[model samples]
Target: MRWDGVHIAATGVWLPGRLSAEEAVAAGAYDADEHAANRIVSVAAAETEADGGPSAPEMAVRAARTALRRAGAAAERVSAVFHSHVWFQGADMWTPASYVADRTAGSGVPAFGLQQSCNAGVSSLELGARHLEVGGAVLLTTADRFSGPSFDRWRCERGLVYGDAGTALVLSSVGGFARLLSTSTAVDNSLEAISRPASPVADPSEARRPLDLSALADDYVRANGDPRRLTLRTAQVADASVRQALADADTRMEDVSRVVLNATGRSRMRWQLELQLGLNEKMSNWEFCSEAGHLGAGDHFAGLDDLVRSGQVLPGDRVLLVGGGTGYSCTSAVVEITESAHRPE
Candidate 1:
């Protein structure tokens, strides 16, 4: 939907130490062949829970503090907190959104969790933008730690390496460095089986086992037959969303200074950048994504934060943000930098 007065007050990102792909390969944790094919230079790696690293929600709190500090007085107006995630958030059946809200926005503010897979970040942005229409600021946060016993960050998926990071964005109607022009979303629920197991598991324990996305995808292909039709549909909805978002913003692709997309591997990213968007890596935030890896639902916000902090974007520059998730949902947004002083504190 098109937005008028909504703005991105501030953004904050908390990234853990890095682990080079080469190191993972040398340590036998990563397949050398897969590393060569993916070309993901490095990924943010968090320490194990036993090593005292912050949990996913805790990292969100740290990022929220940074954003709240940057927002200054604007933070006081936040009326709700929306936390997004993909993997297990430290505990089952517990509300991570409430934990984040208490640590950041404090109690009494309505808190909600969005589990729309990787698209939740952009979905949260759209939701927050809508909430801003009702007269208050909204806090959007996404965090995920793709580490060990439960998930093998390196081997759990094909074409993507998971990362550990927390990202936050504050939206306000008052003032900010960037103006939110528009956001759009499209979905194709028929593609959901690509990420689902071949059959439902009756045992609760078996159902909660570690994910093998590569296997799941293979099974889906085998059961569904040729995947070319589904791939075409995916590209169609993604491209349509981007086109509609730009149109709603009253801008064109040429007007956008940068594009932020899902942080998948080279091949998948190429499909989005070259085939779907008709743009190359130079026109997008692929450099940041290549190093950080896929940060679950945090890619778009973290990429926007990096662009703003690094001063790669200047005043009046327009940025296009696109996100897609396994549930076969796509969301696109347009943001225009209204100031040149968005550097980190």
Candidate 2:
């Protein structure tokens, strides 16, 4: 849908220490052949508080403060706070969004957490833009630490390496760095079983052991049909979402200067986005994503922040943010930078 006055006031990101893929291979934590195939060099991994690292919510607070400061927005000025995550956020059934809001944006803001898999960041932007009124501001944050006995960041899922990081975007009706033009989302429920466990259960312990995604995928294919059909449908939906977003923004694919895509493997990136959209590999943030891995719902936010901070995006340039989540949902957003980021703060 088209947006009228919503703009991105500022963005902030916090990435923890990184672990090289080669180091994982050397330590027998990852397979050499798979690493070569994925073409990922390193992934951001979180450290304990004893090592001076922050928890997921703490990182969100840090990033939110930076974004709010850059936007010159006081805690009282924030009307809402939306935090997204994909893993256990150091607590069970606790309100991390409230923690973030109380610590950064104040106590009375309408703060809540969302779980849309990896698409939550972009989805939050879309939702926040719709919620904003004249002169209102919304704080959107995403953070995840993919560690522990339940998940292996390096081997839990195929074709993607999970990362630990926090990202924030202060969006406001008041003008700032970039204008949000349009956003769109699409979903295919048939593919939902791909991420669902093979057997349904009332308790967590009743679920399959190890939570093997590969096994779940195999079961989905066997129960449904060939997996290629699913891939084709997913690519079609993703391409359609991008086209619709651009159309709503009154722009075209050729007008987009940058495309921030999901931090998946090289093959998936090539097939799902670049090749499908006829876009050059250089137009996407693949090189940076290779080093940072997939930061759960924060990939697009972190990627956009990198583009602005590195001077790759300029005033009047158009950018396309696109990604999908395990719910078989795809989303895309079109943004136009309104001011040169090179100007002194």
Candidate 3:
């Protein structure tokens, strides 16, 4: 799955506005003392191209525009679109995958979307890179709004961390950015219950639909408990995927100058790399999620953007991109830096 001559051409991110963790709790987003309280994480409070709701096609399009501009590609020039599924409490599935295509003006680039919760961003890019190998540019965009009514909305505090944002990466075989090098995927369906959305927005009967976590508390607890079975399985699968991805790229972890782990926060931040991935404690410096918040499916891309913009990355350095989804799907991508672009970093 590795490629020696591949590289990433550009990365762009769009954040609507900040919603402090305290403000979110004051507004009654979640319990004051709950572990997973939706205490403000990063939220896109402005006018998103997608409008921050179910079927957020416009939002996805906006992110795409930024990324394409970064890579100097025009919307009309894009041939394919890959997006991560969006979640808004009480709304679901009304918009089809084709919705993104329509907003991009059906400019001939087909569209596909992933609803794999957290893992959707990486998975979408993996597929988009494959399209790039065919000698064309592929637009890969990820957008999420955890501010919706769903209890799965982001949670945070001084003791916790959260966030929201959208990201766009222009991937192509033409030139620029980091080469995708390789991607690895591992699945443990046994841990499937760890996270999920109970009902689609289409369900007409209110009773047939789950309006809030009040009714599904039991299910949520069983699925995401303190003794998180998903966390353990994720560690195993993610570690395996990282090793394999690096091996595919003919590299090693020590060789990875930059590592982006899903939003590093209080509870999970300190030991996330060591306890979960069996890695050394030094990686805490590059953690991106917590400061960025959970970002729904936008986790990895946003983190990657930060790295590029901060001048934290350098040419010839290998970057590790990793994370997972609700179904326990995890992925690792190895990228080699080639351009500076002055990204701040």
Point to the candidate with the largest TM-score: 1
| Residue 167 lDDT in candidate 1 | 94
User: What TM-score do all the candidates reach, one by one?
Assistant: 0.97, 0.95, 0.80
Q: Root-mean-square deviation of each candidate, in angstroms?
A: 1.2, 1.7, 4.5
Q: Please report the candidate that would top lDDT against the real structure.
A: 1
- lDDT of the structure predicted as candidate 2: 0.86
Q: What is the lDDT of residue 92 in candidate 1?
A: 76
Candidate 3 per-residue lDDT over residues 33-139, each given as its tens digit? 64353222444444333664432455566666677667764333567777775465224655444565666536456877667767888877677767766666777
lDDT (10s digit) by residue, model 2, range 127-159: 898878646899999998877567788887788
Q: RMSD of model 3, in Å?
A: 4.5
Candidate lDDT values, in order: 0.90, 0.86, 0.63
lDDT per residue (tens digit) for residues 17-92 in model 1 = 8999999999999888888878899999889789989999998999999898888777999999999999989887
User: What's each prediction's clash count?
Assistant: 0, 0, 31
- State candidate 3's TM-score: 0.80
Which candidate, 2 or 3, would have the higher lDDT against the true structure?
2
Quality of model 3 by C-alpha lDDT: 0.63
